[model samples]
Target: MRILYFAWLRERIGISSEEVETAAPTPAALVEELRAREPRYAAAFADTKAVRVAVDQEMRGWDADLAGAREVAFFPPMTGG
Candidate 1:
């Protein structure tokens, strides 16, 4: 799957996006796998509440299924002035 990071998430992870190969069933599971990869990934996903997810461009929760998903993006919650 193609994983993308936005806003500060990209900065924190030190990359905008990357293709990941995993057997994770849910977005949360994917996060766990990423967090276990290195310190940067761990730090980037330290707070689940502060982050939002999109699977194939549709907003979804951490428990959202990743079956056949081609893209998954992680970003901070949006704010409007």
Candidate 2:
């Protein structure tokens, strides 16, 4: 799957995007896999409640299934002015 990071998450992870091969079933599972990869990923995903997820460009809950998903994006929660 292709993963994208935005805002502070990208800054912390030190990358805008990457392609990953995972057997994860859901967004939450994917997050756990990424978090175990390294310190950067661990730190970026430290507080999952503050993170937002999108699967194949559509916003979804952490439990969103990732089966056949081609892309996933992560970012901090947004606030409007």
Candidate 3:
């Protein structure tokens, strides 16, 4: 799977994107796997509530399945003034 990070997520992880191999069934599971990879990933995914996810470029909840997803993006929720 191709994982993309944005804004502070990218800054924290120290990369814009990465390819991962996993058997995770859901987005939250995938996050747990990534977080186990290193401290940087752990920091980036520290607070699930503060993060938003997109699977295959479409917004989804943490419980959303990642089956057949080619891209998964993590970013902070947008704020409007």
Task: Flag regions of model 3 displaced more than 4 Å.
Answer: none
Which of 1 and 3 is the better model by TM-score? 1
Residues 1-81, model 1: lDDT tens digits: 999999999999999999999999999999999999999999999998999999999999999999999999999999999
Worst 10 residues of 3 by lDDT: 62-71
Residue 21, candidate 3: Cα error in Å is: 0.8
Clash count, one per candidate: 0, 0, 0
- lDDT string for model 2 (1-81, tens) is 899999999999999999999999999999999999999999999999999999999999999989999999999999999
Candidate achieving higher lDDT, 1 or 3:
1
Give all candidates' CA lDDT scores: 0.97, 0.96, 0.94
Question: How high is the lDDT of residue 57 in model 1?
Answer: 100
In model 1, state the lDDT of residue 38: 95
lDDT value for model 3: 0.94
57-77, model 3: which lDDT tens digit per residue? 899999998888999999999
* Top lDDT prediction, candidate number: 1
Candidate closer to the true structure by lDDT (higher is better), 2 or 3: 2
Pairs in steric clash, model 3: none
